[model samples]
Target: MGYAQLVIGPAGSGKSTYCSSLYQHCETVGRTIHMVNLDPAAEHFSYPVSTDIRELISLDDVMEELGMGPNGGLIYCMEHLEDNLDDWLDEQLDGYLDDDYLVFDCPGQIELFTHVPVLRNFVEHLKRKNFNVCAVYFLDSQFVSDVTKYISGCMASLSAMIQLELPHINILSKMDLVSNKKDVEEYLNPEAQVLLSQLNRQMAPKFGKLNKSLAELAAHVFQMSMLSLLFPAKSMA
Candidate 1:
């Protein structure tokens, strides 16, 4: 009935910017989409928001009222959102038609998507609402320049894929800022052996086995779990 893209990534990975670009693209093509702000800590937006979770709970309010740190406040805000999904979120969904498309701009907290149950529960809620959901994860193009960083990014993406249990897309964001595009392209769809060789050269010989295993796992994750790698520059252009 409905379609949704859960835009998630680490801090500074350009989730909001991606959402704004997507909104503009859809507008240009004469397609309608609702951009929902799921990040309670978010202060500004370049695109119009159809639904906002900050209406229910906000990290700033939580931190000020409960005397909690930023991380703790974010977790608290998300948990509060989970608690009100049946009420607040359901009400928000009721405003849109069954065929409407929505883009949820989520927080940059890595733990929320990886090991936490909050986002999983949110996804389940969307399913119950008869919405087909897909996760669009972003990684900064700059972050994957080295073998180790590439492996780390792959692992994080894989973790979110397993945890979310939805059709997943990995996007390398901020490609416009990558001066040497070839360096970032190699990690986009690299061979497992190539990654292992690079890792072996960078890491100590004692870490050879670990490096090989990591490279293989990264390759497997990309080949199997990830639907595809998207470059923001090309996609938005």
Candidate 2:
């Protein structure tokens, strides 16, 4: 049996930085954990990679050979990886020891984790390999300062949680960068009533019903799916 954290988030949400920090912290304390790079477009990463999907299929080659744009090429690249799962990903993971902890730094493509079956299939593969997987989603702290953006992040996260259907964690990344920590404090401890009140003030009163449901959705996933998982990082392994 092995344990894994599937680190996922939007583009520029500090997913790689988080993985690098975790790797460095673990090394500093004399702990063993493998970092796997699942992003084919990843050009520069500081952490040592145990398994890399680019070794199998690269996004650049797909773009050039297939005559596809970046977005289409990325989807195609991931689909190629998905198709080779039984042969490629299986072989890569087979070498890891039982009970070894791994953190997979996945691509930022929202479709892969949201509606697409690709990431879901990837997690299924991990489970078949005896991995206890948790989807760790990172939302940029700066993006969620306002009510509308906050709801957007919440909804996106909830969609990913339901799609993945694994243990989920929502992290507000770049908290340290936000000079006024108090500014983004409400989102950290999401309260339905507070969100609703704020939403009512910002959005038109005619859309009150929509705001309420959105707040309820936000509160439900924030509490039931993610809140409990926001413990000290060192304890995850």
Which candidate wins on lDDT? 1
Q: Candidate 1 — which residues are off by over 4 angstroms? A: 225-227, 233-237
Residue pairs in collision within model 2: none
lDDT by residue (139-180, candidate 2, tens digit) is: 888787788998998888888988999988888777667777
**Model 1 collision count:** 0
The CA lDDT of each predicted structure is 0.90, 0.86
lDDT of 1 by residue, 8-62 (tens): 9899898988888889999999999999999999999989999999899888999
> Model 2 misses residue 97 by how many Å?
1.0
Off by over 4 Å in 2: 225-237
Error of 2 at 84 (Å): 0.6
RMSD of 2: 3.0
Query: Considering every candidate listed, which one attains the maximal TM-score?
Result: 1
